[model samples]
Target chain A: MSKDAFFALGLLAGLMIAAWGLGRKAFKSKHYDEMQLKIRATGYRIGFFTALALMAVLMLLFELDCLGIVSPAFALLAVLMVSITVFAVYCIRHEAFLSVDGQGKRYIALFALVVLCNGLASALRLIRGEALENGRLTLSFGSPLLMTVAFLVILAALLIKTVKAGKEAAE
Target chain B: MKNLKMKAARAAKDLSQEQLAAMCDVSRQTISAIEKGDYNPSVNLCVAICKALGKTLNDLFWEE
Candidate 1:
């Protein structure tokens, strides 16, 4: 809710919109094949359940007054990011993250860029010791940190899947 | 449960998985999964593969 938080939120939204615009043509459901569509549907189902479970956990923590330093907004945002990351990783591993005609190298480049930018922002916050305020994580630090970690996890999954696919193809 | 018939048909046509997948408008992994019995293709996909390989549905997909 601070000025930094507002700026961070704005940046996050802008980045997401940019990424979505860049990926929409390559990743649209209409561009996916039947198998990819099925796999993605499964991914969505899994992500939905993951979000539900995470929300339940968050509610429980709130009831127990255990969510000490994390703001409700940040906690909710983290849950959303985690759920989206889970869906993306699952789809990527299953070879359904991209359309049949998609240029995966392009998508990988985009993901790498996202990770790099968010990681740098997070590092800046950490170095400046601005990630925390009165021993509590502020939205400014938590948002970028969460984005960096989530995208890093997705990038790792994509890379592993690509390697495995390459090996399989070679065999 | 492996689709040996489909694989044999694909091989008979001298098409690699990637080639066949391209012809069928699916990912190579999808074709690989189908042949390996790791995933089942829908009827439409079966038709597409059959058409691409110049095989009948019975020739490629019908279990003996």
Candidate 2:
């Protein structure tokens, strides 16, 4: 297999595992309380808004690329990144990011693992003496960087929410 | 408006929020939120809570 194709296959497997873990809670909504369902609905609403905004931004950037102003591949990567960002943002927000609960800690730890994976990916590339790319595991829509970006977004939202909640608690 | 009636009923039954939540098959936060007037539960949940408290819906949920 071509390097890109092999990379894509590996990325697909990793993403599938992660997606299963993330979607497990959502798919088992029947087991959740009305309050939990309500929170999940809030996540969908926030995700809708985030996706809409990303679409608008992508449109503008795509036009710029059409004008010979930017590289071509970046536009596709941007689309993938935006999608993961929306999912990450919505899930983190609805979960009350960094909540003082076991589930919250698990999400936080997963976010940390994403960063660690990025480091490992980069380190592997260096060992192979290949040019390092920040977020392009396979290019097109098959980038593992999509997951990393999503995790980073979750981390960012959690930190911000944690600080805000702390202040609210003090008051 | 908050459901102080339901809260009072639960209290009279000597039930903690967690115990009442278990009886209603809900989280304690949901029960607490209901009492705080932050959440309006479904009819089914209301009926369940009513049964658990040994009260009529009119006694706990309805004002009149």
- Which candidate has the top score in DockQ? 1
Per-residue CA lDDT of model 2 for A9-103, tens digit only, reads: 66679779978986777665435578767776776676667667766876786676642432344445555567556655665554432332225
What TM-score, over all chains together, does every model reach?
0.89, 0.67
Prediction 1 global C-alpha lDDT: 0.84
DockQ of model 1, rounded to 2 decimals = 0.74
Report how far residue A41 has shifted in candidate 2, in Å: 2.4
lDDT of each: 0.84, 0.67
Candidate 1 lDDT, A1-171, residue by residue in tens: 576667766977987997888778744544677778888999999999999999999999999999888878789889999999999998987878754125666767878998899889889989998887876787888888899899889888877777776676678
CAPRI quality of model 2: acceptable
Q: Give the clashing pairs for model 1.
A: none
**What is the fraction of true interface contacts found in candidate 2?**
0.50
Query: Model 2: which residue pairs collide?
Result: none
lDDT of candidate 2? 0.67
